[model samples]
Target chain A: MKKIFLILTISLVFVFLSGFNEVVASATSNFSISIVSETPVETTVIFRGKAQSRSYVTLLKDAQIVAVTQADPNANFEISLTGLSAGIYSFGLWADDTAGRRTSTYFFNISITEGVTTIISGIFLSPTIAIDQAEVRQGDILNILGQSAPSAQVSVFINSGEEIVKTTGADNDGAWLYKFDTTSVDLGDYSTRVRASKESEISDFSPTASFKVSKKSVKSKKKCPAKGDLNNDCKVNLFDFSIAAYWWKKSLPKKIKKRVDRKLYRDGKINLRDFSVMAYYWTG
Target chain B: MRISDLKFKLVFSFLFCILFFVFFSGNILAAHLYFKVPENLVGVGQIIPVNVFLDTGGEDINALEIGVDYSRDLLKLKDWSDGNSVVNLWMERPGSDADKLIFSGLIPGGYNGKRGLLVTLNFETLKEGRAGVSLLDSSEMLLSDGAGTPAKLSINDFWFYVKEGASKLESDKKKDSDSPEDFKPEIDRDDSVFDGKYFLIFATQDKDSGVDYYEVKEGEGGFERAESPYLIRNQRKKQEIEVRAVDKDGNERASLISFVPVYPFWNGGIIIAVIMILLLISSGVYIFKKKN
Candidate 1:
């Protein structure tokens, strides 16, 4: 009986050791991309681009909507703004996918002169993604979902100890899904992101999703407010913006670490991406 | 050399001069920079209203730096206005130095439109002569691309006459009688600025005469002249604060915030930080004494 008791105590200690329960630092999404293209042309300027299929794309001048167009089934679009006076113009493109989700606004500062058709090409909208489960048990399926340019190739990248990548295609509605099996994934932390590519153009990565490979699954909770709602008030406003502003450009120190949601962004420091995410989910 | 050859050379030289001036001169006004005043003639004892404007010749620009040169003997800068200016953020507001007024600013998203109002200057006329006002040749407009590229531009110098017998000040009938636009002031506390003290930051614009200055009032204290990012004297943060933006025309716009809560006494973070600093200093002194 004495020998059995000592054995049981040793077994309990071994099972509870720190090495067997390693923790992976959760990731926060970071993505703010700005691209500029110049077209040397006369009065008439042509903008050609690809967006989510059947999505509405609008042109903005100095934050004011000037024109709008709907993408074709092939995700191709062209907007010709005529009767334009000769001068400088700050032009931008904003999109709404079939599901009515808005993409990040892309701006182009261009100079217009008189003469030929100046075609500004290669505008590919970035993809928006989300995950169904916050955490999954080993050997279970994690479903990733999002919308992209219609029929475009979608690449999902899962990063554990080793990076696993797979490709799928968006349907005509611009919706794509990838079911990821976590059986082979080590029992550690994981981050996954996606990107979309068309004929010759590829977009930047989507918001990074973070989860853990644990013994039990945790369904994504909608009760929680959107990212950047630091006060748990279910609203993102100037109060939350100020909290992030205090950490601007500072490499988050361990003492003040993880005060923000991991899904907000984890660039080496707080930057425009963190602000962009706040703007994306702003309640006011 | 033959007489025929001399004639040919003279004719060629004349034609070349004409062509050069015509072609380049046509392009000279691509980005028109000029000054607009109430009139060319201003009385010696009156104020001269100077408004600077820029037409970007169709190029989108995001940054600008301008320095003005004027005759110190003829004009003295009485005041300046940033009202309704194209610049969204000013690195340096118009600062007067000797005979020059310099300013630098940025338009975050960028601006690409004609006749963008850059700034307004009110000069007190001193002498009766031509007040030749012009921008320094070093001034520049950078393209809006992520990369700061120089945009092609043409600089135009302006001259206005100040006559001795000129009549009353045109500004007496100033059109910018309207008050400044509404704005909100923010309240914040930061460890970096003012050593964790609370402060207020605020701004606004006047479409006509422009904003001249700001005033801040704390609790019941009399209003005092202040600038943005002002340090709060009441660190306890238990006071009502009001900020007012006064335009060049003396029109004022005020925003008020209710009482702000005092910093909590239970903030153990502050106590621990003070203790950590004290411990480090004591430890250093002890090591030095032991070494000695």
Candidate 2:
């Protein structure tokens, strides 16, 4: 009778233990997955969460793996996404532990708001002017070198004129040079300014650079100024003689002919003879 | 002694039966099916993704059928996908007939887990209103206990509001000329025995018009649309990776990793040479045998 009681007790304990094992084996733990992200995500999004440590985390969109990462020691994971088109996207976060003992799959419903297209105003810097020859002869080629925004179209204007005298594109180095012929321009002082433009954006004109176009200067001839009017006064007097005396014995070049005549006149040399003529015409 | 022993046996059996029922029955009742609808503030014409899930609790669920109802006038079903679902065999692929989404699938050996993703449904807001999403009572979940007993499921419905005045959507239409700022990406190579993959991560800001997207290409392949913290699938030998950051205004900036050698032995040139030598030897043997 004692043996029977003991046997039955052992059997019951075995049955209970086996039942407990079954329950434990089939028991499932709580797995919660949450995504913290701003709704109406535009071009990029970040989804972060905590999961089983060393788990394989996969982010899916339209049934394709868009991004993937692994959880760290603290069971924290983060995924960043960029360049998404404006539309609704069905995304899923699936995590499988390294031991393959557990899996948690969660789906998220998100809407990608249409991104706003924006127009950007570009910065336009003024160009610089560097002339190779500041003073050039007429009909000569003037090399105008300058720097502006890289790859910008530089318009070189002459004499501050509205018309663009020359147009050239700046190289990748932002350096440009224009060969302008001075033949069309009048013989006088001229100034040039340049502006750089790219697409629709135009920069301010550069500082003006002044240059001279040198041509032979012509002198006007006057009638032989009445004997001793060396001072160019209508009446010859002591003042004319004083002016003549100041230039006495001075040799004049062929281009400069004096009007006063005395003995040995027409000679290139200005002597006492020219002074005596001025004295003779003295009315004072 | 005999009478007392008989009484004790009977009591013990009764207690065992009660304990078994108490523990097992609770497991059977824990299975549930529901929709996870995030409270979303959307604009008219905006598309949104919604997910349906099955919480097995502790039960092994083999098959299930779900029916979702939504407002037809306020929303339009755009598309749906069953990829990455726990069900291996699908009895019915998720589809939308007007405003309702119907789905059913079978999982062999049943799925024993806390949660399983069923399907992802995409819907576009048609107008400004509150769109209510709920699971119909006709939805059924079958247990994997071989008898195909129906599992009890609790349904939770949620609402999403589609408003008319979304200022952000209104402001996105202008042209933005500011190029995305220059950025340097961090590249990490994995040579560990378990994972042999490369990870690239970087972040940049576009003050004007916001950043639109990023693109990455390895070797000579065409640029693939990608994002920061992206993974490179190639684990072979040396290759170049180029990444471009593009803003909404079509302005772009790029960064490149010239050469990254993940595996030293996986050389294309050596592989081709070996293949050529094998072909030559095989052809020579075939010709020699024919002559003999």
Instruction: Note the DockQ of each predicted structure.
Output: 0.02, 0.00
lDDT of 2 at A251: 54
Most lDDT-accurate candidate: 1
Clashing pairs in 2: A83-B213, A109-B49, A116-B172, A117-B172, A117-B174, A118-B175, A118-B176, A119-B175, A119-B176, A120-B177
Q: Candidate 2: global Cα-lDDT? A: 0.59
Alpha-carbon lDDT, every model: 0.68, 0.59
Task: Give the TM-score between model 1's chain B and the true chain B.
Answer: 0.74
TM-score of each: 0.50, 0.28
Q: What ranges in model 1 sit over 4 Å off?
A: A1-284, B1-32, B96-99, B150-154, B166-177, B258-292
Residue-wise C-alpha lDDT for candidate 2, range A120-172, written one tens digit per residue: 11324345565666677888877876665567788988873444477998776
Q: Which residue pairs collide, candidate 1? A: A28-A262, A42-A113, A42-A114, A42-A115, A87-B58, A88-B58
Model 1: per-residue lDDT, tens digit, B1-292?
9996676567656655655554444334456678899888888978787988978765666667788888888999987877667664454589755446878655544665677878888888998899988889877777655344666767778998899888776445445666665567777665544456776766555656777789999999989998766777876657789999888768888999765756575673677888889999999999999999
Query: Cα lDDT for residue B50, model 2?
Result: 73
